[model samples]
Target: VSLSLALKGFGAWAPTIGWCAHQTQTCILLWAVSRLRPKLCWDKHRIKEMLSYGLGVSASGWVWYLKTLINPLIVGRFAGETAVGQIALAIRMLEVLSFAKAATYRISIAALAQLQSDGKRLKQAISEGMELQLLALGPILVLASWIGPIVFPLMFGEEWIPAMSIFPLLGVTYLTNAAFNLHCSTLYVLRRNWEVTAFHAAYVILFGILAFFLVPHSGIAGYAWAEVLSIVTYVVAHLSIHRLIGSPNYQIAAIWWAGFTIAMFSYQLGWWVVGGLGLAFLLPEARNRLTTYLKHFRALKTG
Candidate 1:
């Protein structure tokens, strides 16, 4: 709320001001709510122990942040500012659509860390996380894709229509991200930070290479396709997690993901949106899963 209001008032300076205000507010709230305080003393052994773990997490984070730079540095060089803008618009839309993934990611790390020692419980947690994420994200994605063509021009201006071409493809990318995000969190909770780091490194490298080769020829759509294709590499994370704590129940999640992807693409392709929606929402298994989740939510609320 502060950020939005700041944007309205401060315009370009809003981010810096809003971020400072937000952080200050968070600090104050934490200070008020928590009993913890900073100590003036430190232990060398504990410091070293923390650095050993913290360094790996920080390394993975830095590598992940490199992804944000690839498009501007690579795509801008190859495709020009217009193409970069289109891809940016698509990515921004995707980020908004991926709110559920972002929220679950933070929670999963803590929750899965507790279950890391038990393979059965860990697997169940991961499966439930994926299901709940998809259930929350799927309909919103479908609705956005359905209305985007009509709304994008009106909202962001007609100049950004090219972004619509690749929005669904990037939607697929985020959908996959939402589904498998827990696997990444699982690796982190298990203290396999380097493994996650390796995955991030590989993804950045693959995306860069794909953009370098494809963007010059295919433009922004090429960039979007690169995103979609690079997500296939998440198979590496899946394999890593399987070796650690077995695999989650991907069967149902896969059905919904596929249907959502097709539905998003249907706007670009043809009338396949009907088939996609049917597959996602109408399947007996899909319906049953939805009902199960709803009941679970209601039970929790009522209980």
Candidate 2:
């Protein structure tokens, strides 16, 4: 079967654990919001739009995963199951990072969609979201950057030693990736939907082509590098979209990227202290806004 056909089968054959977890997260958030605001309208068109957004984004994820799964299939058939199993387990571990980044993006989507105005509110929502994402992912990147290799052998077995060289790079790459994904919410909220699709295409096409040529020669390391390069391409495409949409304070982009790097590189001894400081800075603002949201939700429910 063709790769496309095979992927269709694979997607149907067994839902990925990652996909399942993501769907569960999305459903839980939607359910919580609905319960909090019982009167929110949910017509067919609205349901369709929500499903379209979720399914469209879900397909992008599945494309990368299907291709990742294919590599092990090819390896097991051509080389040996031991080689394939090592790569499979390693890839599974790498997927944990991808899912973490994706979950943050998903939250940003719901958060942005709840805000007012397609232009001003969307950008502000995304900016605030970028702050929260950096705060959440910063220490994670720090710990992973330092200990990715040490943890791998214990988690996936010593046979996966080849993955050691790739894991730290993969972790750092997630920092960039999480930043890029924050814009996905912006793209959708502003109705710049095609750009979102285009970037997802860029990620898959660039990664697939690079992996196609490089993996056979360089092994899982090649695959790892391909993924990192693809993430960079994804980030660039989002920046281009910002320009195309009339760039709104490129400072927003700078703040997110620079802040993430600073947070990641700061002294580990004081990182948690810094995180607490950030909460102190943001809490009053966040609390007031959340209180307003709850008031609206309560009014909707009571009505």
Candidate 3:
């Protein structure tokens, strides 16, 4: 079955091609490597350690899968298809946020794992990782929030107009998660895997609980608010676990929250763009960084 579907990918019908191709290629490479290094030693203790790690990974995967998978059912049951559809549509925007986060995680897990025992380096890495996440996702968040209402209604038709309302709040959810997303990786790399899983489990339960109260009363936006609440709870837990495990004191960032609040108010006052641009200057450090980036870009163009 896998073979036929993989073959179908050659004809450009790659429905399940990624998983099939990745597995097949991995097995083939591993077999080749084994044949090339036939005297490879297998350590029982090391295997056991890896197995423990794998178990934690498996639990986390299943827990999160169930969380995401079950969310739609709750939405559909409580809020109906229109709300579900709106949420589903808004989620496509989340993929954009995920891409920014994925890059930060890849670098963070690698760097943090190397510096796990060094308090100074780990702190530096964590601080910088959070900064990079903000740098990457910040402007995107601002632009999307500013433009989505005007764009989504036109882009997806009138039925999806409802999505524009909930999406900005979900963008807030994504932004909140990004603040502590790297901490989850740091916890996992430190072998505090269960903590990460526990955080996610709490997120799932809290989301469901919030959904329970909000969905029936507030409709689709209720689901979005539920997500916001869940993101807040989970990120707080993630950071507390980080500190409990001896991670450096990362300054709880209120800049984004403050800026967002101001922007929302400015938006109400019909000066959203001006207000959002004002955020760049909210912090002296951010202002300097923007100036440096602009200067470098100008230099590059001139030279």
Candidate 4:
């Protein structure tokens, strides 16, 4: 739809039209397959139950979304429209690259909820989920970080090249997100929404503060570094999950994450990319886990 519109010289309306068309199709498909009809009804008790659970999720989501505005508001104020555009481009690129991580996070919520009553299973599930998320994300990040500098200027325009400077930093930030986002999901499954809300609040607040101070001094790259530094605060979510289900052994994942992050940051220096990936792939624990995961996936496919 978008491509057709763009080709027809109506490119400005293509994205909106395409999005509406996709949503309309989804709604129609759900109506046909779900086989449920809405009835006019009112139930105060049910409303109260839903509000109790939903309000926290909504509140946390709203607060979490505020981080998105920091670049526009803070960076725009400190730098200018050009800086904001560069940051926006970098963020859009990350969004596209992080799609798999986002999908897994959503699906894992229901899966984690089923195991909520079993601590051992819950911890194991979180560990496995994190490993798979990293495995899926690592290659995409590496490839993008490697080729983006070369391809982006040609594809987008020479004016957008500066965006690639901070792309790797934001990539590492998303990589860290893949590592710990399931902890947030675990909190939700346990009905600990307020804790998640608190963590998100702190996250936005910290990002806002860092952007405020850094953008003026260091430019957009400062904004990216702020995101990388804010990852340390994920410990709040980690501790919250630990108190409930005990934390998973992240030793193996941590080593790989560190190596991958360095590789991305130094990919321009030539050998860091190979060295970092080599370290991650050669780790005995990571190789064993990957083998086990592949076997399980094959069994599920065949069975």
Candidates' TM-scores? 0.91, 0.61, 0.77, 0.92
Residue 40, candidate 2: alpha-carbon lDDT: 62
- State the TM-score for model 4: 0.92
lDDT of 3 by residue, 26-81 (tens): 98999998886456789999989999998996787677666665457888888787
Candidate 4 local lDDT, 60-115, one digit each (tens): 89999999999889999999999999999999999998999999988989888899
Best by TM-score: 4
Candidate 2 C-alpha lDDT tens digits along 33-88: 88865576759998998887777666655554555554565454544666566666
- For residue 202, model 4's alpha carbon misses the true position, in angstroms, by 1.0
- Rate residue 301 of model 2 by lDDT: 100
Q: Of the candidates numbered 2 and 3, which has the greater lDDT value? A: 3
- Residue-pair clashes, model 1: 0
> Candidate 4: where are CA atoms >4 Å away?
1-21
**lDDT by residue (tens digit), candidate 1, 18-39:** 7788899999999888978877
Whole-model lDDT, candidate 2?
Answer: 0.60
Candidate with the larger lDDT of 1 and 2: 1
lDDT of each model, Cα atoms only? 0.85, 0.60, 0.70, 0.88
On lDDT, the leading prediction is 4
